[model samples]
Target chain A: MARILVTDDSTFIRRRTCTILNRTGHEIIEATNGNHCLEIMQQDKPDLLFLDLVMPGLDGFGVLKTLQDAGNTIPVIVLTADIQDAVRDECMQLGAHTFLNKPPAEAAVLAALTDALAEGERKA
Target chain B: MTSAAHSSSTRQLNVLQKDAITELMNIGVGHAASTLHTLIGHKIELVVPEVSLITLDDYHQLQPYEADELLSTIWMGFRGGFEGNTSLIFPTDSANTLITALTGEMDDSPELDELRAGTLAEVGNILLNGVMGSIANMLNAALSYTVPEYMECSLLNIFRKNHTGNDTIMLARTTFAINELKVEGNILLFFKVASFEQLLISIDRELAI
Candidate 1:
């Protein structure tokens, strides 16, 4: 089980994602927006992050750009309703590992978690 | 600018520009329907969205219902790659039906209790965010949204509260359905004349029209 951070301004989405991850025996930390997301990462690094793109403060794109500039390699799985191809491509270019639509399928979340955590282990 | 001038300017949009705007609104509505389905674990079917562009005065003329009809509204302001005020307006009855469907609680009064109001705001957040996000993605612009606020007021008051000069309203009416239950609501996005001009320029560049 990996330690994961979930960031989203929507309480429902955050709680739902946390519930799904908890079922997999993973430790979950939640943040409401991009600024909070960065704050959490600085204090304690998680194995993976589930980030939402549209947020009140700094959005997911801002977070990704900041991480890339800081040379942080944390694998971020973007969770968002914005599924446009352009968005997907941009996130990937910004170093996102995978993209999942909001209210993600449990199986897909687990699969992504496995892939991201495995990558983290390999790098460590 | 005067309301008359604003109305004429909005009416001057060529067929192509109008069609493009409608297509963008449809994409946004599609995103909202999918998100709603995910949240409720219910299959949601969104009827084809109808987009209307009108001045606030024109909007007033279009309201045929009683002036005092109460509405459940979730309002938010957005800025960044695009700037606008967005509100999800549901008739009292429709709002009650939706809250009941989501929470399994029935309330006769149209006014949302605190718990129900919170749920409604969250729902509005997801729906509006999806809509605005789709538009932003197409424009390749980043957007920042204000926290959504829930209010119960008459339809006339709702408009009065959001009134501003040099505003063009884009109203998208769509029917949301989960089996037998149907909720029809309007996702109203109000853009300042200047901001809307920026939107048009961005669209032209993005679509290379």
Candidate 2:
């Protein structure tokens, strides 16, 4: 089981994701938006991050950039309801371990976490 | 600006427009409910006939409570000669409840929640856009859509900014048999007067031409 941080501006989404991860036997933490996510990230690093792209202030893209700049290599999963493919691809290219569509499949979420964990193993 | 031509063109929910719009949304949302039924493998009971229009003013008067005030919303901006925004909101409780159904699991699992939210967002996207896009296609007018913006908050507060203004809204209520989750809320459709008029014209032209 892994301690995973789930970040999105939506409460429904955060709770929903937390529920999913909890069932998977991983511990979960939640944040509302990108800024809150950063505050939490600075304090406790989770096994993985699930992020939403468009938000009120600092969005997921900005959050990913900040983490990357801070030299944080935690695998990030980008979630979006928008139609910005180019932006999503860039996030993946920029170090997002994987990108999945909004309302991901259970298989996809597990796969993403596994991939992120494996990447962490390689880096370690 | 609410000019004569603009005011005249921006008609309220006359019986026809109201019913037609509502009916179209019914077709759209009915389709969405169908998608949910298939995706989650649950029997969902929904009524498109319940769709209606409300101004931002009436929206506030209908003041709703945020069960888990911490917010989560799926949003998409739509524009063309017409412009609008469609949002699918799942409060915390609703999210958990729906997740339970979609996963076919009785317990609340964190990973399932995440997947559920993502699934809801996709489902919302498919539902909202499915209806809206189909409407646009019927009119043969072009609309550009931005990816959905996922958000959270005191939903009541989200609409406080322009509550006095006239805004078209579509509220969707969905109930799934498996989890017995009752998800009901409004989908706000905001647009400038001109854009709305353009949308009407598109519809009219689609009907006539």
Candidate 3:
């Protein structure tokens, strides 16, 4: 199982994602917000991160910046309910590896996971 | 009462602000519609009306009828700098029909019902983020959301129990049409007081960036 981190503020959503990812055979790490996600990354680096764009404390952007600034190159996939070009563009500019609109589809999530793993393997 | 004047001023400001929020939501809704069209490979129609701004107290009067708790509640949880609770909810009948159209499945089948929560949550994720994200961007505010959660409940209960207003309230009306069938509901956008200004500043920064 891939060590994966899923960061979101909602208990319901975080649980849902964990269930779905676990069904796909990934070891899951949960964080309620970006701050916690960042702390988790420091202690245990995951193979992938499924990030939500909005939350209390630091947001997805802040989490991403913190990771990049700390020199970690883990693959980050942003899952947002918002579908806007500007938001997408800003996220891309900020160094998010990929973007998936919120409530991500089965196919989309799987594809992102596949690509993230492949990239991680290449780096290793 | 000073509260009246404050509320009235807030209401006027609310009016002016909603236009921008609504227009932004319209853009997001259009994107969602397009995404659904491709996902379902069918022509789905969206009728987005002028959005409204309401207080947490006003939600109960909005919907008196409570649908089946397991079936009616389209439970979605969102997290952001403006993080709190807001759902892109629909009643049971409306939700089931919408899902059937989007997935090309029957509303009553156990299999379809099993999948409906996830599908609706995804749909809600798109709609909520699309509208709310645009508002944040227009204000140039950096925001993010949580993975959405789905649940079923009374409309009033959903509002009364979960909604802790995100500083300011911005809500809108949007209807989804699949050929002849119409799925109707409101899109609620709540942002915190500080985020409201942070948003405007972000917008200005974007202009500079």
Candidate 4:
């Protein structure tokens, strides 16, 4: 099972997402915001990251850019309430492996996790 | 600007502009409903039947809910190309009913205590994000939003706290039906004079394109 980091400012969303991932036997790590996410990444280095945009500070874009600049190839999946095409394009360009809307369905979440893990393995 | 001037400006929108705004709101509400259905595993129907722009002074005349009716409101402030506050407002009873239906909470309390308030806030966050995101996408406007806040208050009190006479409001009457439960609410967008003008410019740009 892969160890994953889920970052979002909303406690409810974090709990919901972690519950879903936990059910699948993946180890779950939580971060409250983007800055916290980066701090965790430096030490924990999870197998996958579920990032949320529109956070309070150093949002998803900032995290993605930081990882890209550091040459980190960890597979990143962006989950956000923002549905703008431009936002999706920016996420992908910043190296997000997958983009999913907020309140994502369980099946879609699982599918994205599987694909992201496989892609990560290939890169490794 | 004076209240009268603001009212005049709001009334200056041509029929086509008003229709376009209403249509955009309809699309946003539709998207929000789809997201809610996916989240709750329920059949959900959400529609924006009408949208009106009026100055805050006109608020009392156009008030949909009784002035003293208690409401569960989820409010989020947004800024970028334009600045405003948007809210999802439901009668307190309807809000409680919705939470109970979604969570299977057996609590019959009419008041949304802290725990339930969080749940409602998240739901509101998702719905408001859906509407705001869709509109922003269509307008090609980038916006930053404050985290959603949940409050229980009367409709008049809410207006008193958040608005001034110089502001303009775009009020959308929204209907929500989940399974057999039917709940009606209002999606209110409050903007200052400058922001309202900025919004009109953006809308005009969208129309021109």
List TM-scores for all candidates, in order: 0.76, 0.52, 0.57, 0.86
DockQ of each: 0.28, 0.06, 0.25, 0.57
- Model 4 lDDT tens row, A1-124: 7889999887668877887899989899999889999999999989899999867788888999999999988999998887877778889999999999888778889999999999988988
Error of 3 at B181 (Å): 4.6
- Candidates ranked by lDDT: 4, 1, 3, 2
On residues A1-124, what C-alpha lDDT tens digit does candidate 1 reach at each position? 6779999877666766888899888789999999999999999788889999877779999999999999877899999766556678889999999998766789999899899888878877
- DockQ-based ranking, best first? 4, 1, 3, 2
Worst 10 residues of 2 chain B by lDDT: B1-10
Candidate 3: where are CA atoms >4 Å away? A1-96, A100-124, B1-10, B51-57, B60-71, B75-84, B101-114, B162-170, B180-182, B191-209
Q: iRMS of candidate 2, one decimal? A: 6.4
- Output the number of the DockQ-best candidate: 4
Q: State each model's CA lDDT, in order.
A: 0.75, 0.61, 0.64, 0.78
Ordered from best to worst TM-score, the candidate numbers read: 4, 1, 3, 2
Interface RMSD of each: 3.7, 6.4, 5.6, 2.0
- Where model 4 places Cα greater than 4 Å from the true spot, the runs are B1-11, B45-48, B61-64, B107-115
Model 4: what TM-score for its first chain? 0.97
DockQ of candidate 1 against the true complex: 0.28
Error of 4 at B122 (Å): 1.6
- Candidate 2 chain A minimal-lDDT segment of 10 residues: A80-89
Per-residue accuracy of model 2 over B88-198 as CA lDDT, tens digit each: 666566766665665566655675555566656655675566556556655655565665655666656555432345554333222223344565544444554456567
Residue by residue across B1-209, what tens digits does model 4's lDDT show? 11122344435657667677778778888898888877767777655456656654555643567777778999888888778878888888678877776667767675536558877887888898888888889898887788788998777776666567555565544567764666556676666557767877888898998
Distance from true location, Cα of B120 in model 2, Å: 11
